[model samples]
Target: MFALITDIALTHIAGRGRQTLVSILGVALGVGFSIAMAALMQGSQEEFVTSLIDALPHVDITDEYRDPPRQPADLAFDVAAYSNLRPREDTRGILNATEAMTALRAFIKGNAVASLKVQAVARAGGAETGISLTGTDPVREALISSFDEDMRKGKLSDLRASPFGIVIGDKLAAKLTVDIGDTIVVSSTGDITRRFKVTGLFHTGVVAQDNAFGLVNLKAAQIIAGRPNAVNEIRVRLNDAQSARDVATQIERLIGYKSVSWQEANESLLEAFFIRNIIMFTVVGAILLVAGFGIFNIVSIITHEKSRDIAILKSLGFAERDVRLIFLSEGLAMGLAGSLLGWALGFGLTKVLASVKFEIAQATEVTHLPVTFDLLHYAIAASFAIIAAATAGYLPARKASKLNPVDIIRGAT
Candidate 1:
């Protein structure tokens, strides 16, 4: 019975060859475009995220608390009003730096770097600029970030060789009119100043980092900031970057400090990506929706032309369910054919896009466009096409199943 129904469906479809072909072509185009769009969008997002992960620490532990600490009066008395209350004075920055580092290294399945950060001014001759100065151990810092790859001139090891050595962004180098071997004066909030030699220059391609950030040796930063044996931030780089969130939570629990994963730090940007994906899929669905209408038109016409045959089949003991199945089969067959053809078309388009080469306008050189070819994309595209085809075929199939043989035959007279 299924064979007979499929045979009838194929005959009806082949009978109107041109219209059927057009309908299939519509579905094919829709699926093909959808697959290519998904590939490009997902590819670009993955590339951006990978770069972000490589550039930053997977988990960052800071001296600050997630919530403000309660005042001594509030904690002791639980009173709303207090007069002439003053908090106790204490030194800032992560306390017991050596102990914390030892504890963290044992607890964490990753590399950790403790760093002192300060806001400072960099002056070279007449030109001066505000910069965020970071003090770190060069050997340890290299484990977490892509600093080695980002170095445009001189090596990171140069910082260790020259105790007062500093690495500035290439853009900052251009701004200060300074180069390697030149001297720059750095002043911190404590009004202490120190002369630092420019040992290296780095270009990370991020304008903010390149334009205003500087790196120096930990001991040198401490001396410049008038602080001894201080570290405010502990950055961790896990072997598996994806486990950052879990590790961050555990670190915060163990150390009583606020730990933040990279994902949490860039929450707003990730939300934007979510919204973009929604928009992308919505557009793809709309394309498939338009293509479904083409299938509807062709099926409706076929039903109208085959009215006499449908009535005859019904009179020959064919059930209405069988009649519906026949048309449904035709729709599904076309959908399957279109989906397969679209897969090939989409693959070709993605390959071509990935092969095209061009220079990016940014400081970094990217020769080829990013494109991901995943099987999930092909599966999603096919699912949309099949569902659209089934819906488009159903309306006309339902109407054909209800046709009365007596009326159809009498009307033929």
Candidate 2:
């Protein structure tokens, strides 16, 4: 019975060859474009995440608490109704640096480095700019950041070669009109000031970091910030970056300071990506919905033309359920054919996108468009197409099944 229904369905579909072909084409285009779009969006997101992971520490432990410390009076007394109490002015650097470092090194399965970061002003001749000055161990810093690879001029080790040497972004260098070996005066809010030589220039490709960041030796930054033997930031580079969130939580609990993973640091951007995915899928769904309308139109016309045939089949002992199945099968067969063709088209388009190359003004080399060809995308597209086809077919199938054979025959007579 199933074979008979399917054969009759195919015959009806073939009877209107042009309309069937057109409807199938519509579905094919929708699925193909949807697959390509999904691949592009997901691939771009993956590349962006990879770049973020490469550019930042897996876990960053900072000398700040998640919640402000309770007042000493509050800690000393639980049922205190305190008023007009001033908070104590405490130093901001991490306490007991040596012990903390030892404990962290023992707990972490990765390389860790401590650094003092302070806000300062850099002046060279007539040009001046506010900058974040970072004091770090040059050799150890390489393990946590891309500074080693981002340097466009001179070596990171130059910071150690000259005690007062500093490395800054290329954009900052251009703004200050200073080059390597030039002297610059750095001053901080703590009334500390020093003169340093420009040792190296790095181009990180991030305009903000390139314009406002400077690096120096750990001791020099501490001296300038008026904090001796202190570090306010500890950056960790894990063997596996994916474990950052868990490691960050552990560090904060153990050390009683705020620890942030790369994902946490870029939470807003991640949220934006989520929103983008929603918008992408919505548009794709809209496209498929439009394609479904084409199927609906063709099937409605077929039902009208096949009214006599439907009546004859009912007279020859075909049940209404079998009659409905015949029409439904026609829709599904078209959907299956379209989905198969769409997959091929989608693969070709993705490959074409991947092969196309373009150069960015700031980038040093040409790059191809990122495109991921995941089987999941194909599956999703096909599923949507099939559902659309089934729905489109079901509406007309229901209408055709309700036709009274005796009435249809009498009307024809």
Candidate 3:
């Protein structure tokens, strides 16, 4: 019985060849465009997040506070009673940083946590330039950062090899007119001046990082900052990035310093990504909805044209449900065919997009438009197409099933 109904449905569709073809093509275009747009947006978002994660710490434990403490006088007395009391200046630098690092290591046993001495210094050349210096242990820092992977000229371990060795960003080296084996003088406001040999260079693919950041050994940085045995920051990487906020909260409680996760640090950018996805999905969904309307129009026309045939079948003892099923089957067939073709078309388009390449200054990481072949996108497109097609068919099918055989046959005569 089902096979007979399907045969009838196919016959009806085949009889109106042009209309059937147009309907199928409409659905295909909708699915294909949706898939292509999803691939592009999702791929670009993934690339951006990957670069951001690699370039920055998952969690940063800094000497500064998220909110500075109130002055002792303010805490002890009400504002109206002791308004003349002066506020004490907040002290800078983490006290007993080495001990704090040890406690943090024990607290987060499985995570990678490394102490770092970060400071700003004046680099003297043709002109004075301010740059950030990050003092790190080559071996331990590698576990928490991709710095070693970003090295372009020499090894990060070269900093360990020489006491005054430093690795600067490629852009920084260019601006200072210094390269490997060249010495650059660095001075801090505390009357500390040092000349360090550039032993290596790196490019992080981030303009800011590449243009103003340099790496040095922990002890050397301590000396340069005039803090002989102290580090002012720590970086952590967890097995699961999503757990960073929870772990950061725990660390802040234990260490009494500012602990911030990457998500917290880049909240604005993450919000932007969220808003972009919503807009993309809404626009693409509207395209699919328009295609569904095309299906509805074509199916409705078919039902009207076949009213006489439907009456004859009903008079011959065919059930009304069978008549409805036959029409629905036509819509389902169109959806199935369209979905398959659309998947193929979308895949080809994505491949073409992935091959396109162009260069932009200061955007070292993006050479081509990213297009991810996510199977989930294909599944979603196909599902949406089928559902839209089925709903469109339902209304016309119901109309065909409700027609009275006697009235339709008499009217035709």
Candidate 4:
């Protein structure tokens, strides 16, 4: 019985071959676009996240808060609390860094933690550049950062071998007109001055980092910054990046300093991605809904043209439910066909996008557009298409089922 109903449905659809083809193609276009868009957006997001994770620490333990919490108001008389705010500048370096690092290592076992000092370096030729002079244990820093992988020239371990040796970015090397075996003058505002030999150069694919960042031995950096055995920042890389926020909170509670996760630092960027996803889904969904309307129009026309046939089937002992199922079957078949074709088309489009080559300024690694072949995108697109098509067919099928055989047959006679 089910086979007979499906055959009848197919025959009806075949009778209007051109209209059925058009409807299928419409749905296919919608689904294809949705799949392709999702692939590109998701791929781009993944790439962005990978770069961000590689470049930044999962959590940073800074010396002090940028803006400390305001003092509580006076309880007596419900009066506002007022205190003299002075312009005295205190040292910004972290105190007791060695003890802090030791405590942190014991607490967060199996995690990578390194100290860093950021300061300005000026050349004797009057060229001053602000650089993040990272102070690190060569072996331990490698565990936390991708510096070893991104090393263009020179060994990171060399910084340890030579106390006065420094590893600078390629862009900074160019600006300072210095190279390996060349000496550059470095000075800080605290009357700390030194001449260091450039032993190596690196490129991290980030323009800012490449332009103004350098690395040196932790002891050397402390001496250069005029803060003996002091570090301004503590960077930690956890086993799981997703657990950074929780770990950061734990660190703050254990120690009396500010701890920040990468996610917290880039909250605005994450919000932007979220909003973009919402907009993309809404636009694609509207396209699929429009395609569904095409199916509705075609099905409605078929029901009207076959009204007499429906009445004949009813008079010949066919149940109303059977008649409705036949029409619904037609819709389901069309939707299934369209979804399959759309998946193939979308896959082809994603491949084509991945093959296209392009260059972006400051993003040296992006040689081609990113297009991920994720099955989830295809599943979502197909599911939406099928649901939309089935819904469109339901209304016309219901109307046909409700028609009275007595009235339809009487009118025909």
Candidate 5:
């Protein structure tokens, strides 16, 4: 009975011809706006989360000896007092970084702490481009974290393959104008220099990590930098990301050192994302409200025009509930139809946006915007649109149902 009434209401609107065109259009526009907003959020948020996840290792344990801190106080004051401290700034220097890296590698492999400092630099394109090498053990790096398959051009170089062999980022490759197997000169802050062949390029789609920090064999890096077995920091990866802080605290106590999480490592970017998300919600909410107005006005007009029909139905011994259902059906039908149409339209539009990349070439050359359409997003947006339409009809439907049968009958006669 409910389904039949909804069908009748939809047919009635079609029969109204040009008069109801505006109503249909309004409903369609509202649904479209809701869908578009949802699509944008889904695409943008996924892009951000995925990029960050790819760029940063899920969990890491760095050496407490020389914490890579932006401020002096950021480093743990509980660090062991080294009687033989180096001059100014950092105490670990090249030798210490290598040793820390070596110990970290061995420790991760279920052995004693193979602490060592690994350092290496890779020539990306020319003097204009720089690709800094991350000194870490190949075995430990492989166990730490991984990126999407599409991002990697090939496997990382052999751990003991070459003294200056380096892994690169796809974004970094594009920036420096280089490719795998290409030879570039690497220079270290310690005045050490070496020529390294690009072994592979990993794309992760993370602009920061890919464009700045590539990877190199810790041992090879140590050799190239002329600092055998000295590492600036020790990095540890665990099974869970959330457990990092607790594990870090435990590690700090056990090793008598400082430890950090991925969140701390990338706080600036995370904060920026939080702000962006809030802005998105604010803007999208306003847009959806504007769309809701379309439903409201259409449902209101439909009730006004069908006054006599509602009255006749009540006079024919039909319950006010039935009359209410008829009007409610009209709004729901409109919502269902429009939401489906809008979903299809929005899906296509997202692809168009992806292909028609932004032309902001001034800062960087990221041509296309990435978009991913997930079914979950579609379900959420469509459900909301339907509920909004149902609610839009409730008041107007109630008013129509409450009308006295005599008034409508008299007006019709």
Candidate 6:
């Protein structure tokens, strides 16, 4: 019985091959566009998050800005607890330099590696430039971030090595009009002025950050601030950036300080990722929805044209369900073929687009686009198109099937 129904539907489709081909192509294009958009959404999210993270410290610890961040009193251990763990290539955080060193030494106990960082602010030249100074210990700082490559000229100062050396961003250095080894009058935000040699120039491609952000030695900053052992911020580096949240929570627990992970610190940017995905899905869905109407229109036209045949079938003992099944089979067949072809086209299109790249600027290069074909996503899309198409054909198929044979065959005479 199923074979007979399929044969009848195929015969009808074969008779109207041109219209059927157009419907299939429409469905295929719609399905392909949707699948490709979904694949690209995830990749784009990752890229955006990475770029945003680069704009600030890797992870931050300070006085808890909100309700006291909870920590178990018993959770007491130094950086030594994870001596065997190594920091990955990309990691940088501002630590309370002096205190962090003391804490790290106590925690490690000569077991393995440890590091330090510091955060300070300087009112540069006058009150106009609010220079946010990042004091770093050269030996440990490289484990997390590299200001070397990001620099336009000169290099980041070694705090333990350079007495009063500083590295300003290229943009910031331009503002000061001071070159390497030139003394720049710097004042801490606390209202104190001091002279420091401009040892180097750096640029991180972010205009706002490089323009206002500066780098220096922990010792220099501490001395200038008139404090021997104090810092407002601490950066902690863990084994993996993805584990940064866990490490951030652990740091807060262990040190009794308020801390925030990269994700939490940049919540708005992270949330943007989800928002982008939703927008992409909604837009692509609208395209598919429009294509669905094409299915409905085509099926309805076929039904109207086949009314006489449907009446003859009813007279010959065909049931309403059977009539519905026949039309549904046609719809499903169109969806199935289109879906398979769409997947192929989508995959091919993604690969082609990935290779064709463009750059936004000299600093921002357009790398290959990212895409990954997911079976679940493809299946879901295919199923939706099929269901919508089948339902569309149902009402018209039923109306044709219920016609009285005499009226339909007699041509309304």
- How many clashing pairs per prediction, in order? 0, 0, 0, 0, 32, 7
Per-residue lDDT of 1-413 in model 4, one digit per residue for the tens?
Answer: 99999999999999999999999998899889999999999999889977887789888888886457454554344668566956556566667777777888886744555575758665736566877788888878888888878888888878877898888899998898888888888887666888888988899978888898888888878887776767778888877888888888888887767999889988899899999999999988898899889888888888988999999998888898998898888787788788899999899899999899877776666598877899999999999988988888888999999899889889989
TM-scores, each model vs. reference: 0.95, 0.90, 0.91, 0.91, 0.66, 0.74
The deviation in Å at residue 304 for candidate 2 is: 2.1
lDDT of each: 0.90, 0.90, 0.84, 0.84, 0.63, 0.66
lDDT of 6 by residue, 232-258 (tens): 666555445676677666656666666
In candidate 3, what are the lDDT values of residues 50-121, reduced to their tens digit?
777777777899988878886666787776344566655533667877777788788673445445555566
| lDDT for each residue of candidate 2 in 156-266, tens digit (9 for 90 to 100) | 988889899999999999999999999889999887999999999999888888998999999999999998888999999999888999999999988888999998999
What would the C-alpha RMSD of candidate 1 be, to one decimal place?
1.8
Of models 1 and 3, which has the larger TM-score?
Answer: 1
Q: Which ten residues in a row have the lowest lDDT in candidate 6?
A: 108-117
Q: Tell me the alpha-carbon RMSD of every candidate.
A: 1.8, 2.6, 2.5, 2.7, 6.9, 9.2
Residue 158 in model 2: lDDT: 85
Quick one: RMSD of model 4?
2.7
Off by over 4 Å in 4: 65-96, 106-110, 124-126, 361-366
* lDDT of each residue in 302-384, candidate 5, tens digit only: 77887877777777787888877877777777677767777777777777766876667443455666666667656765676
When summed lDDT is taken over every stretch of 10 residues in candidate 3, the lowest stretch is 109-118
> Residue 248 lDDT in model 4?
86
Select the stronger candidate by TM-score from 4 and 6. 4
lDDT of 1 by residue, 1-413 (tens): 89999999999999999989988888899899989999999999999999899988999988898886887668888566867866665367887878889998997888999999989999999999999999999989888888878998998889999999999999999999999999999999889999999999999988899999999999999998888888999999999888898899898888888999999998898899999999999999999888889888888898999999999999899999999998888888888888888899889888988998898777356577889999999999999999999998988999999999899999987
